[model samples]
Target: MKRRRHQKTRGDMMKKTLLAATFAVWIFNVHAQGSMTIYGSIDSGVTHISNVAGTKLTRVDSGNRQPDRIGIRGSEDLGGGVKTVFQLENGYVTDTGAQLNPAKLFNRGAYVGIGNNFGTLTFGRQNNFMFDMVGKYSNGFLLGSFYAFHPGNIDDLTNAGAYDNAVKLVSAPISGVTLGAMYALGEQSGDSARNRAFSLGANYAAGPFKIAAALSDSNNRSLTLGQTTGIRTLLGRTLISGSAQAPVYSALATDKVRSVAVSGSYAMGPALLHALHVQTDISVAAATATMKSSELGVNYRITPANSLNLGVAHTSLNDMSWDQLTLNNVYSLSKRTAVYAQALHQRASGTGTVAAVNSFGYATGQRQSAIRIGVHHLF
Candidate 1:
């Protein structure tokens, strides 16, 4: 009887220990549950251009829809409503698996931050306040890369094109509103004031109305292309003055650039409307000018997996003007995959000028109209 009692006690102890271990695992899963995820996207398409200067109707592969990318992100719970997070993302070419920009690795985004109930503070290369505020309501976001506004003409102002090495602070949402501010350090060797930029932005969403506003300033940078006049002999005209430079006029003065924008959106059921007004000022060393741009768009959901978009924009330069119209259709194949088609038409008000802005190459002002069909998938 003594032996049997001792064996039973041992069995009971083992069962209790197993139950305790199971409970501990459940507790850990509930409290210490954090995750790291890997994600990526691949976008590619075919494009056709019309009205080339010296080329016939050319059909080529489009590199605009989605430059391929891979990314990894993670978060760790620090208790008391705080968390530490990090992200590393890089862009590449899906057709060749080559780095997008050979000069830099992880060219898209690389940042670390702390997040909590208050807000988030991040440092490293990231999107600026203007991009966050204005880019969200862009027609490019809806019409893909075929739209004239995809690049948005901000490359010459900020480093990494649209993003920069900066520190950003975001405040928590209050009454459906949030605000962000950012500053980029020039970090020059002796005169740390050569290439500095700063921005402030705010976003608010109440009921069915949403609004955003932003302001940005950059010192010692040329933001927009200007016109250059030179005497040339063309068709027996003795001192012909025309736009002699390409997209970026090389001989013009260099100075600071400032930009401000306001945007708003409204959504009801399956239809959404958006509008934006942006102004850019060029303070040249000798002459100053301003550019104004405005966009209006609407999107309608035909079904749970399909959407239709239309947009129009007009931009007035110092000496020239242009208008663009875009039409797009998107069909979702899955939660993270979609196929899209876009058609854009742009009109210029000059004798030999076209409203063309190139994001990946330097062949600006060479295309008149373009159409694209593409697929985008995210994982």
Candidate 2:
């Protein structure tokens, strides 16, 4: 009897051990189902500009092709064809290692939302819908491969084109077409419309052709009295920290801004062609001003690792007009790394427009030129 009892006890212990092991494995599998990922890119280059403030300048610059940034993205499956998602991104300067926007930690993007079979609804600081659609047709996504933009990126299609306290939505592509919209709260104490912002955009892609259209508006953009010398001075500083592009009008206290743009691109074999047009208006307490701009560009892929980009843009506001041309050659050392050389030339005519190339400020004469050699890497 004692021997039989011992055998039965041992067997029971083994069964319990196996059961515990199976339970642990099941727990591990359940935990592994959710995923989070961290991703980003870094870029830097050497640049030389002729006639910035009447002097030649050479320095190290960040993001000649694309802005240097780091971001974290996470997603959790909630079952029933729905998921929860979040993203946080930060922008920095490679040369100085300074935050792109000093006021906010995740200045580039920060959003949380849910996604279902229908679409996505997100809330937080985010890029406008117009910017999202225009990226498809703007050369290399925007600003003519980052060499130059339309006289201060007047259409607000370039970097840092985000809105605060906003809600945005993106619909899944249905038959190669998608739509996006966004509304931002100005958050002024008493007046809801004081600094409100909103945008709408649509995009379509089929075969080798793509096109997009967008419209955006902002009201009562805040401006620092000390930093903004005049309407043009403040407008030129739109990309800098504490400044925004909402389509301001006059040199006096500006109130409202609006913009409309359409862009398209066609890819043919090794060559790609792109075109864009934008019209922006600003309203101030004193008067209203309108600016219109157009751009045409082409990209040729010589090899899987080598490419050439060229672009030309023209912008006009009242009596002021400006023109810019850019050419860049990019050679990829690997899938995530590249070395490039670029040249840019710009001219300003008409009465009020000064020769300004991006953030370089006013050129000495009506014409200015620049050259850059740079490297970029993705992670």
Q: Tell me, by TM-score, which candidate is best.
A: 2
lDDT of 2 at 317: 72
Candidate 1's displacement at residue 290, Å, is 1.9
What tens digits encode model 1's per-residue C-alpha lDDT throughout 34-139? 7567898888777666644334344545345554778888888989999887888888876677887897687777889999998999988776766776667766
Can you tell me which runs of candidate 1 are displaced by over 4 Å?
A: 1-33, 57-67, 150-152, 155-163, 222-253, 357-367
Candidate 2 — worst ten consecutive residues by lDDT sum?
222-231
Cα lDDT listed for each candidate: 0.68, 0.77
Candidate 2 off by > 4 Å? 1-33, 140-144, 222-253
The TM-score values for the models, in the order shown, are 0.78, 0.84
- The deviation in Å at residue 125 for candidate 2 is 0.4
Question: Which residue pairs in candidate 2 collide?
Answer: none
Model 1, residue 270: distance off in Å is: 2.1
- lDDT value, residue 29 of candidate 2: 71
Return the number of clashes found in candidate 2: 0
